[model samples]
Target: MQIREARADERDALLSVHRAAFGNTEGEAAGDTIATLAAELLDDPTAQPVLSLVAEADRELVGHVLFTPVTLADQAVQGGYILAPLAVLPGVQGRGIGSTLMRAGLEQLRSRGATYVMVLGDPNYYGRAGFATGHQIKTPHEIPYPEAWMAQELVSGALAGLAGTLRCANALNAPEHW
Candidate 1:
C-alpha cells in the first residue's frame, strides 16, 4: 500500500471510500452526508489551505483524510487545522490504513508549519495518534461527546496560551457536524 496526496481526478473514488466507510455503520444517508461534507470542504473557499490525502492498495483508493483551516474567533491563529471525515474502506478498516494516513497527513501539516491539529473522533482511536481531551480551546458548537473532541500539538508548545472558541470552515460549521 502507498499513501500520497489525493489527485483531483480521484474525487469520486475518494468520496466512495468515505461512503463505504460510514455506510457500513450508519446506513447510506450517513455515508452520503459525510461524502458531501468532504466534497464541500474541497471546494469551499473558507476551507483554503486544505490537505487531502489518500491511501492506495492494489492500485485502488482505499482510504482518505482531510485537514482544513480552523481559527480562534476574532483572532489570528496561524497553523490551526482540523481533521475531519477520515475514512478507510470497510474491508481495510482494521489494517492500520487510517492511522497511517493520519500520520502522513500530520507530517505534511507539520512540514507546512502547522502548529496544531484538532479532531472530533473516538478517544480510543485518535488517542493512539497523540490527541488528547481537556483542551482549553473550545469547538464552535457544543459537542455531544466532549471526550471525543481532541487536539494534538504538531509543534511543541503550539497550544500554549491559546484559548478561545474554534471556528471551522463554513462547510463544517453546522451543528449537525459537531
Candidate 2:
C-alpha cells in the first residue's frame, strides 16, 4: 500500500470511501452528510485551502484524510488546519491505511512549517497518532462534543500559548455536523 496526494479527478472515489467508512446512529451507512462536508470544505472560499491525501493498495483507493485551515482566537498564532474528517473503506479499517495516510499528511504539513493540527475524533484512535485531550482553543462555531476536540503541535511550543475559539472553514461551521 502507498499514500499520496489525491488527484483532481478522484473526488468521487474519495466520496465513496467516506460513505463506506462512516455510518449513522443505527450503524448503517450514512455517508452523504460527511461527503457533503468534505465537498463544502474543499470548495468554500473562506476555507484556508486544504491538503487531501489518499491511501491506495493494488491500484485501488482505500482511504482518505483531509486538512483545512483553522483560525485561532489569537490571530497571531494560527491554529493551522483541523483534521475534520478521515475515512477508510470499511473493508480496510483495521489495516492501517488510515494511519499511514494520517502520518504522511501530518509529516508533510510539519515540513511545510505548520504549527498545529487539531481534530474532533476518538481519543484512543487519534491518540496513537500523538493527539492529546487538550486544545486550549475554541471552535468558531459551537460544537457539542468538547471532549472530542483534540490537538497535536507540530512545532515545539506551538500550542503553548494558543487559546481562543477556532474558526473552521465555512463547510465545517455547521453545528449539526459537529
Candidate 3:
C-alpha cells in the first residue's frame, strides 16, 4: 500500500471511505453525518491550509485522514490544527492503513511548521499516534467525553503555556460534532 496527499478528483471516493468506515460501526445516518462533515470541511474557506491524505492499495483508495486549521482563544499560535473523521475501507480495518495515513499527514503538517495537532477520537487509538489528553486546550463546544480530546505537539514543548478554547473551522464548530 502507498500513502500520499489526496487529489481534488478523489473527493467522492474520500467521502465514500468515511461513509463506509463509519457505517460499519455507527448507523448509516452517523456515516452520512461524518461524510457531510468531511465535505463541508473541504470547502470551508477557514479550513484552508488543510492536510488531507489517502492510502491506496491495488490502485484503490482505502483510507483517508484530514487535519484542518485551529486557533487558541488567547494565543497567537501558528500551525495549530484538528484531526477529524479518519476513515478506512471496512474490509481492511484491521490493517494499518488508517495509522499510516495519520503518520504521513502528521509528518506533512510538521514539515509545514505546525506547532501542534489535536484530535477528538478514541484515546487508545490516537494515543498510539502520539496524542495525549488535551484538557489544557478547549473545544468549541463542551465535549461529553473530555478524554477523547487529544493533542500532540509537532515541536518539542509546543503545548507548554498553551490554554484556551480551540476555534475550529465553521463546519466543525458545531455542538453535534464535539
Candidate 4:
C-alpha cells in the first residue's frame, strides 16, 4: 500500500472511508457527522494548512487521516496541531493501515516545523504510536473521556512546561467531537 497526501478530488472517497469505519462503531449518524466535518475542516478559516492524507493499494483509497491547527489559549505558546478523524476502510482494519498513515502524517508535520501532535483516541491503540496522556497539556473543550485525550512530542521536550487550554480548529471545537 502507498501513503500520500490526498488529492482534492478524492474528498468523497475520504468521506466514504470514514463513514464506513466510524459508522460501524458509532452508528450511521456519527459517521455522517465526521464526513461532514471532513469537508468543513478544509474550508474553515481557522483551519488553514490542513493536512489530509490517504492510504492506497491497488488503486483504491483504503485509509485516511487529518491534522489541523490547535492553539494554546495563551498566544505566547506557538500553535500546535491535533489529529482527528483517522479512519481505515472497514474491510482492512487490522492491516496496520492506520498506524502507517499516522506515522507518515506525524513525520510530515515534524518536517513542517510542528513541535507536537495531539489526539483523542484509544490509549491502547494510540499509545503504540507514541501518544501519552497529556499530563502537561490541557483543553478547554470538555472532553467526555479525558483518558483518551493524549499528546505526543515530535521533538524532544516539545511539551515541556506546556500549559493552558487547547483551542482546536473550528470544525472540531464542538463538544460532540470529543
Q: Pick the candidate with the highest lDDT.
A: 1
Ranking by TM-score: 1, 3, 4, 2
lDDT of 2 at 73: 56
Backbone-clash count (model 2): 4
Which model, 2 or 3, shows the larger lDDT? 3
Model 3 scores worst on lDDT over the 10 consecutive residues at 134-143
TM-score of 2: 0.92
Compose the digit string of candidate 3's lDDT tens values, residues 1-178.
9999899999999999999999989989989999999999999999998898989899899999999999988788878989997999899997888888898988999899998999999999999999998449987888789899999999999999899989899999878899
Q: How much lDDT does candidate 4 score?
A: 0.89
For model 1 the TM-score comes to 0.98
Give the per-residue lDDT digits (tens) of candidate 4, residues 72-138: 8876766488998899988999989999999999999999999899898899999999999955677
Clashing pairs in 4: none
TM-score: which candidate is best?
1
> What is the lDDT of every predicted structure here?
0.94, 0.82, 0.91, 0.89
Query: On lDDT, who's better, 1 or 2?
Result: 1
**lDDT for position 9 in model 4:** 95
